[model samples]
Target: MAGEITETGELYSPYVGLVYMFNLIVGTGALTMPKAFATAGWLVSLFLLVFLGFMSFVTTTFVVEAMAAANAQLRWKGMESRQEEDDDNSSTASDSDSLLQDNYERAEKRPILSVQRRGSPNLFEITNRVEMGQMASMFFNKVGVNLFYFCIIVYLYGDLAIYAAAVPFSLMQVSCATGNDSCGVEADTKYNDTDLCWGPLRRVDAYRIYLAVFTLLLGPFTFFDVQKTKYLQILTSLMRWIAFAIMIVLALVRIGRGHGEGHPPLASLSGVRNLFGVCVYSFMCQHSLPSLITPVSSKRHLTRLVFLDYVLILAFYGLLSFTAIFSFRGDSLLDMYTLNFASCDIVGVAAVRFFLGLFPVFTISTNFPIIAVTLRNNWKTLFHREGGTYPWVVDRVVFPTITLLPPVLVAFCTHDLESLVGITGAYAGTGIQYVIPAFLVYHCRKDSQLAFGPGAVNKHRSPFHHTFWVGFVLLWAFSCFFFVTANIVLSETRL
Candidate 1:
């Protein structure tokens, strides 16, 4: 009964949806969005901001529906079990656990002592009639699953490189809340040109490493009980609302002082790119996809959801931009804007500021699982061939190492934070999000022209249609090439 709810929307709370969006767009790009505001200016910026929201909505919805459908069919076993899995889908015991935590914990500890073979259990075999599993078999299926698997990894990298950039970016905003002298901006200018210079970041610099380490620590410690953090969902909705309010109040305040204030014009394009990425991330059908694929995702819901989600994303972004623009007085950097940067003691809005400050810890907590897996698995897959049937031998010993790697690497090899982070946008950032999905969508879609799979373009289309797909393929290929080259150049220059 509980498991069913887990798969079903009944157990799927709105806050989980909010986390998806926050995780999707909240990272490093929040800082860079100012650059977009600067490049496009306020007016053009609005349209660009919205355009990203729109496209992401459409693409994400499609990806979610399609990929999830595939996951459902593939995750489980035979046709009979697949059908049973769907029926039990919403009824899965874990689904019930969400409503009652104590019972769930009690259940988890129950011994699997069912004469459980001491040897490696066949992952392929199903003990029950209704079991549907990750159950990877064929090479292509494994590869396909791994492809979507990339999303979780890149998601964190973006947060670390993109969102983490905001710590420094928010400094400038902090300076405004207080004075430059008190904020220590002028003095820090002689020290580090990182996000601290953006506002009141100097105050936190001495403890930034400690803060970063603390955040890193928080992610894994809570791993065994992530759902316990579900209470945070309520807070997420509140912050988003606060952010919305801040955007409005601040935009109105800065109406005349604008013109070309916060994020400029071309920056909007990148804003669009990140939005597109978020939509992809949010619309990702992976978590929910494996359960109900075809019927549950009716075309109507898809259309409405896409439209609504994008509008909200843009609305939220526009607000953030407005608040940051006037607050910084036009000197804002792309990777340095935190909502709390200018906020220390505004009694009325102090809560918003506090959460803004807490945002990094949240991101690190959410992202570390994916990073640990990426670091550990990639380590084993690439370097360590020795494997135990037990996943823990690999997962436990090396997961902590992966968590600690980022700080250690950054500490050892110092580089410009903004430029260094922006550079990641080209490689892991590019391939993990953009290139991989585009390939999956194109390949899986029945008539997609760029499908790397066997039957993409079929006998059905007109010459014009054929030309359109061919052109589309070229466009993606072009983008991929550019992204790869950009990374190479950026990495080389930094080295």
Candidate 2:
């Protein structure tokens, strides 16, 4: 059964919807792209990034189509319930039996509404809000629904781990005294975690301390509801734009001054595996579409809006990655691109340097709590039983504790942002982005065919509606899993 629509907030225009989607898709993932591009070479990264962008867009449409189908199913069931109620009322009223019979005959002749034919499709109406979880329950068999939730849970865990590591790593970079103190130093210099921080603590020890501090501050918020206020979103978005623009402009200036030192290869087959994962991670938005799309007042041009957004995003990624690979040597490029500008010489002004240094710290800090709460809720939903209630301890303490601990522990073990992003995106991210949407759209199409017969058509059907597209997505997903698995196995053996 579809759950009750819980998001009853103010509706927004399509323009706002576009911005929301842009912000959601272009988050922490983009910070790690420049490094991946550097490792994989510019030509190969460019081709793979573009191809992945197209594939992600195709699946996004699949998700929107599934949402419309879920809404139609809910509307059909409600209509059936009302029809049954009318029949019962008509039978019970003995005093007006003749009148009821005449009205019933008229109804039979005209059929309450022509569109309400017993098996006709209700494709045009978009009234209900069916979440991804609800849509899974509606269309997926028992095993499919369970797997969907499992995939989502794993994806969210990765998201939290990335966030957990990012915030502390950024803090360490800014607060510690390190080599390459000036941006004009050798482009290939390396910094190790064993280097000293402030007084006695090594950089790695400081990182652990910061992680503990981060967990203490943000962990409690998971137990409570997190309402991301409008003003806070705007502020963070403003900071994000400023940070990105500064990175691009700084890279352009450095490259223009004949300081360009990168010599990336034409293609590096070894790096392609990790690059694919990073690109896939960057284009993720399917899981959050229900919450994002429901509040938009105008959806007639949603497809067009999504197309424009993707085009803009692709161009932005190309610009950012191209400049970074040219301006800095491949080995020197930081996992988080903003740190490349943290040095005083590259960004002369101390204020600008500070802003760029702390950019991720500011923006991702806000998102950490929100994601933690979402993960907690998904845990509850996964184990929840109908007409059953959890004990106070499990509801308040156990769920929150489990939700907060795993990712924190993962962050403590290592701060390798590239590997973290690569693994998460390649595995759980693939299931959430490619496999699930393909199956949801395929099943939704089949269910509609059975319910409304051959003549029925979904008004919101994906442009890539052929069954071959679904197979292609699944095939791509399988191939990715195989390649990543093989790479891991070979690397382990070599070690």
Candidate 3:
């Protein structure tokens, strides 16, 4: 009880919020997004960026609001806990009364930041009072939030493995790009290339094992105390942005020069393309919109914070997509420039191709944990419980590990990137990123209140803000589901 977080849902420090958002968006997409430009074309890809950006904002806002609800509930529970402590002989009645009086006086006397407590329960009761039945509604809310997180975890692990499989296949091709006669050139018509090379470290079946490891590591990463995990978050984020730039360059080089004959991005399968179907849906490592609405968020500062995030997200994504589109050949998508680089530059473009080729590895390394956290917090808020608290280790490690296992196993078993991407994108990506959020948001908005919060330097609150959030989530879900599913069906006979 001593260490119990009595006042939950407090907005974490701004640094954490900013980092978290950045982290989420900048992952595997860095490598794969360029390929999207190739398929959709620059114009379509830009539109995709805009559409995804807007939906992602809305979904992020909804998440923020939901977090606020949970945090507020955490605070309320804390108040109740104190009441119980007082009743259980925390001190003599006289002492308690005196302390109460002193607290009242001190609260009034504290600095300007300490405002008068004026908010009501702010929770939806099945029927306003009895307090206990509210538990059910609370449970539903938390479950919804945590459920979202769980899906994300599932999606990321499977996604990461699928992407990772592409890496080795790309490495194999470096030899011929430099005009080395030693590099056996495979016949394009035959769909056979002798110049391609796999990573030196891999076994014929290494993909399976790698996928398992990448997928399962979410536990060690996420459960290790997020409070102190800032460093790893930063490192990953840097990698993400750098990768983004590299992707753009790759796309530009291929798309710009009129290669008399177009080269197909070696990764032509639909499954692999899903990595760029929509936004990264990452847990940004830093003043993200989600943090703005958490119960702990300073009400005075909420509006400005949310809008700032919206702008930052828009700018980052829009720019990245634009550059990526310019980097590829028009006719060929996925890895259109697959044969453009020689083996000598294998360290350069080849490394880029490998990672870009392997989207899931980057995703599983990060996104799974973020989504799980989303679920846990939402669960607590909905249930309004300190009891049966969500276990961090389960989602962070066990669940994520389990989710990634199949991809890794498949990679090793088949060494086939095409199959894994198709299955995961059709099933997991479709449901998690697109369908579910959209559905949940629609339901929430049907009978709700609130509007989007204000811009920064202009802090203000809106009534029925929750309603707006529901709408936002729905947008993201639908986008993800439709785009991913369509592509999967196109690429695979199985899906």
lDDT of each: 0.42, 0.86, 0.44
2 against 3, candidate with superior lDDT: 2
| 1-495 per-residue lDDT for model 2 (tens digits) | 122333545677788889999999999989999999988888999999999999999999999999988887787778779978876786676557776786778678886544446345455445567789999999999999999999999999999999999999988887773432434222354678998776788889988999999999988999889988989999999999989998899899988998877778778888887798889999999999988887777688888999999999999999999999988888888888888777655777878887888899999999999999988999999999999999999999999999999999999999999989999999999999999999999999888767666566677778999899999999999999999999999989989
Report the Cα lDDT for candidate 3: 0.44
RMSD of 1: 13.1
lDDT by residue for model 3 (328-351), tens:
334333342233222222224345
Best model per lDDT: 2
TM-score of model 2 vs. true structure: 0.94
Tens digit per residue, CA lDDT, model 1, 182-219: 43222112234343432454534533544355446554
**Model 2: lDDT to the true structure:** 0.86
TM-score leaderboard ranking:
2, 1, 3
